[model samples]
Target: MWSANAIKSRREALSLTLTDLAQRLDVTKSYLSYIESGKRAPTPEQAVLLGK
Candidate 1:
């Protein structure tokens, strides 16, 4: 499960902002925001990248 809490935690653990993570993931900040807010789910590809 790609939990929002996990995403937030991992980003924090790496000292990354949503912008930073978005840049790294080649996605928009708003898209990442939606994912984090549980308004949307990431694609399998995005999930893999985000998981890493």
Candidate 2:
């Protein structure tokens, strides 16, 4: 499962907001929010995309 808390913690640790992260990853803030909320799962490819 995608750990919502872990994602939230990491984002906070990096001092990044959802929009900031999404902008860096070239994705929508709503999509990142969905991932953070456990409402969606990123595919391995998407994970790699986000990891960049």
Q: C-alpha displacement of 19 in model 2, angstroms?
A: 0.8
* Clash count per candidate: 0, 0
Query: Global lDDT for candidate 1?
Result: 0.89
> What is the total number of backbone clashes in candidate 1?
0
What candidate 2 gets wrong by more than 4 Å, as runs, is 49-52
Task: Tell me how far the alpha carbon of residue 7 in candidate 1 is from the true structure, in angstroms, after superposition.
Answer: 0.5
TM-score (all chains, Cα) for each model: 0.89, 0.74
The residue-level lDDT of candidate 2 at 49 comes to 56
- Per residue, candidate 2 scores C-alpha lDDT tens digits across 1-52 of 3476777777889899999988876779999898889888776766775555
